[model samples]
Target: MQPINKMKIQFDSKSANEAFARVVVSAFASQLDPTLEELAELKTAVSEAVTNSIIHGYEQMEGIIYMECRLFPESIEVIVRDEGVGIEDIEKARTPTYTSKPELERSGMGFSVMESFMDTLEIQSKVGKGTAIIMTKKFSQQKDRSFSSER
Candidate 1:
C-alpha cells in the first residue's frame, strides 16, 4: 500500500539524540490518532532502537543515524539505521540481557523491548557496515461514536 505520509531524518548519533528521535517519530505518528497507550509504546520502542544505534552501532563514537517513518492506512513503519560496527550475530544480540558491552552497563534488552512493544521488528546488519532496525505497528480503530449516537 502507498504511504499516506513519510518523513526522513538524519542526525549525529549522540546520546542526546535518543530522546529527540523518539519525540520526532512520536510526533509524526500522531497523524494516525493512536491511543495514548499505543503512542507510549511507539515512543519507547523508538527510544530503544535509537539508543542501540548510538551505543552499540557507533560505540558512542561519532556517526550518523538515519530515521524514517511512513504512515499507512492502519499502520506506521519506522526504520532506524546507523553506519557503525554491526552485530556479528543477530540472534545472540536479541537474547535478553545479552549485552556485548558489559562495561558500559548496557542492559541488552533493547531488541527485546522493541519486539515486545511493536507488532513486528526486523534487524539487518553487516559486521563491518552498520545496523538497521525496521519496526511496524498497527493501530486499532477508534470506536465509532456516531454509531453509538444512532443507537
Candidate 2:
C-alpha cells in the first residue's frame, strides 16, 4: 500500500524537542480527520517514543532522533528512530513498569503507553547502533465518513 502523504524529520535528541515532535506528528495526522481523542493518543505515543530516545537512547546527551509519519486513507504509521545505545533486551523493555533507569523514577510505561494508543507497535534495535519504534493506528471516525461519498 502507498501512503497518501509522508514526512520525515531529524532533530537533536533534546527533551524540549519531544513536544515539537508530537506537534509535528499530530499536525500531520490531523489530515486524516481523526477524532481529538485519537489525535491526543497519537501525540502521547510520539511523546513516549521521543522521550525514550532522549533519556535512554542518548542518555540525555547530544544525538540525533529521526521521526517519520505516513498517512493513508484512514490510518497513520509513525516511526521514531534514534542512533544511540540500543536496547539490551527489547522484550524486557516492552514489559510494563520495566525501567532501565529506575533511579530517574521513570514509570517504565513507555512501550505500554504506545501499545495502548496505537494498534500495533514494532521495535528494532542493535547494540551500540540504535533503536526504531514503529507504530500504526486506524481512525474509526474517518472510516465512517467516506469523504469521497460526501463529496
Candidate 3:
C-alpha cells in the first residue's frame, strides 16, 4: 500500500535496447507475483511503446530513449519518453490501422496493442518537442473493481 520502488533506464537508439527493456521490465514485474499471462502482456506493451519511441519518435536518428519502471507491490508503471518529433495528434495515432509510415509496413497497432495489454495508457506530445507515454497495469485480482472502487 506504500509507494512503489522504481528504476529508470536511458538507452541509445538500438533495437537490442528495446528487447532488453522488455525483458528487464517484465522480469521486474514478475517479482511482484504477476501471472505468466500478465507478464506476457506487460512485455508486449513495453515492446510496442519502446519500438514506437525508437522507430517513430526518433525516426532512426541519433536520439535517446528514456524508460522508467516503477515497481509497486500490487502494480507497475512504465513510462517511455523521447525528445524526437512529437506526435501531431495523439487521437489519430491511437486509431486502429493508422500508420504514419506505410512504407515501413507498420501495422499501426502499437497503441491498440498497448491498450489491450495494459490496464491504462496515456500519451502526451507536442509538435517539434517530443512524446511521452505512461502505461500502468495492476496485478490481477479475483473480483473486478469498478472505476469508483479503491486502488
Candidate 4:
C-alpha cells in the first residue's frame, strides 16, 4: 500500500536529541488520533531507538542520526538510522541484559523495549558502517476518514 504521509528528519547523535526525536514522532503520529496509551508506546519506542543510536551506534562521539516516519491506512512505520559503529552480533545485542559497554552501566534493554512497544522491529547493521532500526505499529482505531468506511 502507498503511504498516506511520510516525514524524514536528520539530526546530530546527541543525548539531548533523543527527547526531541520522540516528540517529533509523537507529533507526526498525532494525525492518526491514536489513544494515549498507543501514543505513549510509540514515544517510548522512539526514545529507545534514538538513545541506542546515540549511545551504542555513535558511542557518544559525533555522528548523524536519520529518522523517517511513514503513515499508512492503518499502520505507521518508523526508521531510525545512524552513521557510526555497528553491532557485530545482532542476536547478541537483542539478548536481554546483554551490553557491549558494561563500564557505562547500560541496561541493554533498548531493543527489547522497542520490540515490546511496536508491532514489528527490524534491525540492520554492519560493523564500521552503521545501524538502522525499523519499527512499525498498527493503530487499532484509525482516524483517517478515507478508510473509516471499510471498518
User: For each candidate, C-alpha RMSD in Å?
Assistant: 3.1, 2.1, 5.7, 3.2
TM-score per candidate, chains pooled: 0.94, 0.94, 0.90, 0.92
Number of clashes found in candidate 3? 0
lDDT to native, each model: 0.92, 0.94, 0.88, 0.92
Q: How do the residues 1-151 of candidate 1 rate in per-residue lDDT, one tens digit apiece?
A: 8999999999998988988998998899887777889999999999999999888899889999999999997899999999899999999999999999999888888889999999999999999899999999999988564663564
Question: Model 4 off-target regions past 4 Å?
Answer: 142-151
lDDT of 3: 0.88
**Residue pairs whose backbone atoms clash in candidate 2:** none
Q: lDDT (0-100) at residue 111 of candidate 4?
A: 85
Give me the displacement of residue 27 in model 3, in angstroms: 1.9
Cα misplacement distance, residue 150 of candidate 2 (Å): 9.2
lDDT preference between candidates 1 and 2, better one: 2
Off by over 4 Å in 2: 142-151
**Candidate 1 C-alpha error for residue 101, in Å:** 1.0
lDDT of 2 by residue, 23-130 (tens): 999889888788889999999999999999999999999999999999998899999999999999999999999999999999999999999999999999999999
